[model samples]
Target: MPLGVGFASPAAGVLAATGALAALRAAGLGAAHSAVEVSVAQAALLTVGQYLAAATADEGAEDEGTEDEERAGPGGPPFTSLDGVRFELETLEADGWQRFWAALGADRRAAARAWRPFQLRYATAVCPLPADLAAATAALPYRHTAALSAECGPTATEVAARPAPESGRAVPWRLTPGGATAGAARPPGPGRGPLDGVTVVEVARRVQGPLAGHVLGLLGARVVRVEPPGGDPLRGVPPMAGPVSARFTALNRHKEVLEADLRSPAGRAAVRGAVAGADVLLHSLAPAKVPALGLDADALTAVRPGLVHVQASGSGAEHGPGLPLGTDYPVQAYSGLAALVTPPGEPVRPSLMTLCDVLGGLVCAQGAVAALEARERTGRAQRVESSLLSAAQLLCRLGGDGSAPSLPVCTDLAELAADPRLAPALERAGCTLVRPPWTFRP
Candidate 1:
């Protein structure tokens, strides 16, 4: 005979304690129940143990930052900037970021028992993290960090590709005492690069649109990144390395950056003038605001017959009343995603890939490239668009389906992160689990 332990509140702790007895009382559950023990101390100890484990994990995470920084060098820290989010490379070592989050979701049974009311706040403030530290936090693979920085930012090779910086230096405009002196306009020279013959005028803000431009620039397109008169709000974003900073230079490089008040008559005219010669025009204007900007697809096409116009929206052009609710983070959660992350029954935090922006940006770029190719063949202009919601759905489907993806899994960030040799030894084989190596943070 065995003692039966019961939790007074009918909570899982009580159920787990008498698990064996209950299984013996039932028909098929005898083996599963035999593992249960009735001990409040045991339950509490398990909680304490995991919390302590999380703390140790945090310390190790911090140490990784210190050790890697010394080796990564002053100039080698990875940098990422998009929309208004900015973090210095070192901000990656933020204290307790992952540990605290993991602790919050540790015990589902206890969490469900400890219910509380929710409150709302009107505003939240975000601070920039140190560059090297942020690099550690973004935990992007070291290889990706190096490639993105070199490929996106201005490099020695890139400087060599262009005329000397001073070659295009501008002369101040001055009026002569009597009138203006007529100066000869410089003649345009040379054939275009693959994207050379193509001129891109990007009228966008935040990450998605700018990211597309960044990709285009990488492929030899001449991108003239235009922001409103105040400049892209992202310019004021933090993680500022110094005066000009890496965040700004990292994304807007390889192209001309100009600011104009799109609302003003002169600003609108300037954009229209630029549009006349642009092969592609990218904008993120809200659907309702599109008409006011003189940048609706119809207006843009009228100016440049074969312009490849690309736009990115939060919910896409499909949803009616449901559109406004489609932000990237929430979209990930709502799109059967929060349910699909590995450790099936366990609550997992969402990823930081900003998947929506990345995929949506890629889709827009794909559309622009396809449209350009089509124009070469058919000479017809078209509009290319994408939304955050759709991008998430596509990535989720591709991640796992009955049919396997052709591409390799870039990282071990999946629910089934298991070593075939180690998995067979576990007591519970049916449960989904994710135990990526601690070193796999990036």
Candidate 2:
């Protein structure tokens, strides 16, 4: 029932929905939350695994630093000047006379530069005429490059392209009887659903945290999204639906929106007040910023005992606490995801989709709901932390060995809404597209 554009969105939706369902069950609302079908959650993870497999194979021939060298390959060459041309030769090899001159053309230089380490490696390793990757590529096409690389050893392209044979259905979520207490013990709210009385305060930006908040809203939590006075930066993203960004609408629908200047005392006080009464506080600020803002898990829980605090980051809290803030692209590079998608001896290329961000959001929602369950059972507050790096690792490890079948891309939302397979769910949800992929049966 999940519906969206891009490779990762649907899977992300399923993960989010599953987490919501789990939380509802833990809250003794399982019966009310049922009536949805659940899709497998590991599809995106397996895709990451496939990419990781390819990257690992690409690394087979080199020392540990090889990937680093490849990533640094582009900036090292300045293609506009004579020195740049000379440097290219030193690192790569040329082919035929005609191809050699053709390689010198600006378009080919641009292509070589764009492709980076792959073309560089091929030029350096396979060119009979030293110092001309453009000529080498011109003389030998990508298919030939793949073949020649294969002759030496298992190529990354071949490894990545190999079919993943494993397949299994996702395990359904379940909750024990007497798991969640009802009435006064539950947070007060207005809905008949499992999470109807739960209140969630979201202090986050962009896709990951907001998406989690969105899922919480879908599950019947009263989610209040706190943005800066100027509003969430995502609101400015293009492809607007009237005054708001469509992307923002999709991720943040059904949540109460509040704009506050956290830099001001009044703003801080407002947020603190909101958190003081909330059952869950979801945030995506840098870890350091959390303590500075006096919104760390300990601080918030002190105000509201048994509160579930979920924090999301690009890397684990300890690894890069002071480093430049992380995002999807840099994490992909750092995590070797970019290298994984590249063919052996080719330039690294990251997936166009924001896989890590989407998965990180899913993991955050899952952790948040699970923590809520734990808090309800134990009378103890919990701090749930998730990171893009951790999400990437999960994807790599949890993905099955078998390759997934190719799916045709949906051209637009209209096409998605029109699909016979999704129409029933859409109608049931009373939304334009399919509802959450999972439905619970009482």
Candidate 3:
């Protein structure tokens, strides 16, 4: 049985499914593992390896000016666009932080004024730090003096706070197996592939949850994507053919789509009916709405017995009391990704693509797969949760590899599909730039 729920981006779902497959292999339930997860892990390792290579280069050199220049590039105003447009700030070193603070305006200043030094430097958009200055302010409380030498201009207005600690041991995913007394039986279906007999009911919108379902479908699960009455809001996003969004098509290719509004009684019944037969139930609804929809882990598992329930959110369920309003962009800013990309004396430049959302989806998928494997062993249902914030933190932990080659950004997926680098994958998937990085051989 496989059930995964997620609420972030397509990437979370993809990763969660991959994670489930990995757990299955680890549990000796199958011989195959998720190629997607392996590919992602390799990429992350390569990045860290590059960082290590750079860090160890000419360690004994007193003045590594060449290396430093190569890492940061020739000192100039930070670039604001892919086309290399630069924004200039006319302020001396002494006035840099003051100008930045003043430019932030009153509300942003009030929110950021109390940040600790490391928090300010890592979390806020005050300014960029010179190498010596960054080293000096490493552990101190944020101070007006430190602000004076900050070189970056005002960017974001929101204050970044550390995520609250989990109240108890944080389980990445949950599993609940059917009791022997409850008549736990293997689902009736021919194994289609690695996830052959698994049936996933995806009651989620946007990228994260749906994407996970999509990956499961690729792996041979029968994934049903439940949408609200009219359809998912993402279906209307631009670059459409007819009424379908290309982005939507890219993320959701093989899954079955259903329309049911959870807000109505009939819709709720429809959803429950779908889940009743499903091995996995995945959703990305806000925590506050779960109980109302009768989709909460405890509620669903009570009826389904051994159902695997997964939830994807912007933040962990316990961290933010009300509805989680986070998305990839905000998570990136809060997680210090913006600062990493921004050059000195410039505004923060977020990646053009939704990096956190993608990663979050993959992680959610991984957790879901792991839970499925646990259920097979324990005959119990499992509750799994993932968030964009957590995904961002994981990405940051990978650190930087300044020595890696600079690759040009691909503006068009169609163009990328034609490139020799991706042509084989594109041909096999029968789609343009829509294949998962790894191949799945039966």
Candidate 4:
């Protein structure tokens, strides 16, 4: 344990925590698998660890240079404290897997087999739990919490969970009554048909972009599906079903469908004219080809300043290559999305059609709504871009990691379909539970 030899630093702490979490998760600890909450904790730990390491190093360095004070730690992230701890995760892996494993109730031999390294550079500290609690916090798996909850029954799990109720009162889930209504209540009336008067100009390609427009149409947008001359390439895509297939119809339904080649001047003009009178523009133009298609933000804005422009791409605007330059599988593999959905190093086996498109569409729609609201307030339209990369990254749920999300957000078809409550919700939105494939095809 010489000077910097075996001393614990913030980065060292993050590595230890991440390693501990990984080991616990691999052991099938249910609590550890709760990605949402655990990631927050890990992020905090990393940030805190980074701060301590920096401060300790700065004070100990007798010949510290002025630049050292200004230079941010390893990850170059600003250190901010929350709940008294400041840290950041600089790297996912580092050396010293043996020590990490030993902390998690495993012998050195066992640790060697299971050990993998991680680095955390927390720059701050918080004093909430005692030393014992702090040490246990790093080693504790989420499953332990879950198991404890089962012991308490009904709502015991929620009660014992950390960030506990402010008053230390444990309220059971069943005991909590529903039906708290706010504002003036109005009498419920008869529901109307789907997409009665909403106007939509769908200049979409591939499954995700157009399918989103289709969903909007199903939910009551008067979707005018405008496609190129060859029709949506998906129509001719392999794995074809009957003349019209499930994939196509599943994505498109209840809309005024039109076929036009946007590549042609006349076609582009027609689209411009359509947009001038449309409420929303649904597009999934390939990023590289957006300008060529005359469908960039400026052009669309010129056509209809008030239009809610929603775009979906293979990769988001942030990334240089928006979509896969080649096939879907290769793109998925390249994005690392396929890996998360499938087994490690295995080919991606996506379920329920183009999952990215589906989720991207949903995200695009949500963004469009926000944009529309913004336009209403400011009397100006905003271009909204939701790329495949962004959509994929969101799916990954990389909380506080400063990394983009990486997967589609969706429930399995079976899970949603089986739930009786979800059916009414879908129906109310003007979405047809069934349809022909031709409807979805561009």
How does each model score on TM-score? 0.48, 0.61, 0.62, 0.45
All models, RMSD in angstroms: 25.8, 13.9, 13.7, 24.2
lDDT (Cα, tens digit) per residue for candidate 2, span 18-98? 555464554463234435444543333322321222122212212323343434333322112322211122112333222
What does candidate 4's lDDT look like per residue over 229-253, in tens digits? 7566545322223343233444554
TM-score of 3: 0.62
Q: How does residue 86 of candidate 1 score in lDDT?
A: 22
- How far residue 104's Cα lies from its native spot in candidate 2, in Å, is 21
Which is the leading candidate under lDDT?
A: 2
Local error of candidate 3 at residue 414 (angstroms): 2.8
Off by over 4 Å in 4: 1-197, 230-243, 320-328, 344-353, 398-442
The window of 10 residues in a row where model 3 has the poorest summed lDDT is: 1-10
| TM-score: the better of candidates 1 and 4 | 1
Q: Tens-digit lDDT track for model 1 on 1-442?
A: 1111111112223224223222232212111222333333322222122112222221221122233223433222113322212222211122322232123232332212111100000000111222343334245443444344334331110101111112211211111111111221121123212343457898876556776676566444779888877667655433332333233444455678767788888888788888887777877677778778898777765676666677767666565432224344445444443333323333332333344554555455555655555454444665766666555555454333323223443232112223454343211212221121111000
Question: What digit string (tens of lDDT, one per residue) describes model 3 on residues 305-377?
Answer: 7777888787765464222236555566555554544444545544434565556666677777777767776
True-structure lDDT of candidate 3: 0.51
lDDT to native, each model: 0.42, 0.52, 0.51, 0.40
Backbone clashes per model, in order? 22, 19, 40, 43
**Model 4 residue 106 distance off true place after TM-score fit, in angstroms:** 48
User: Which ten residues in a row are the worst by lDDT in model 4?
Assistant: 168-177
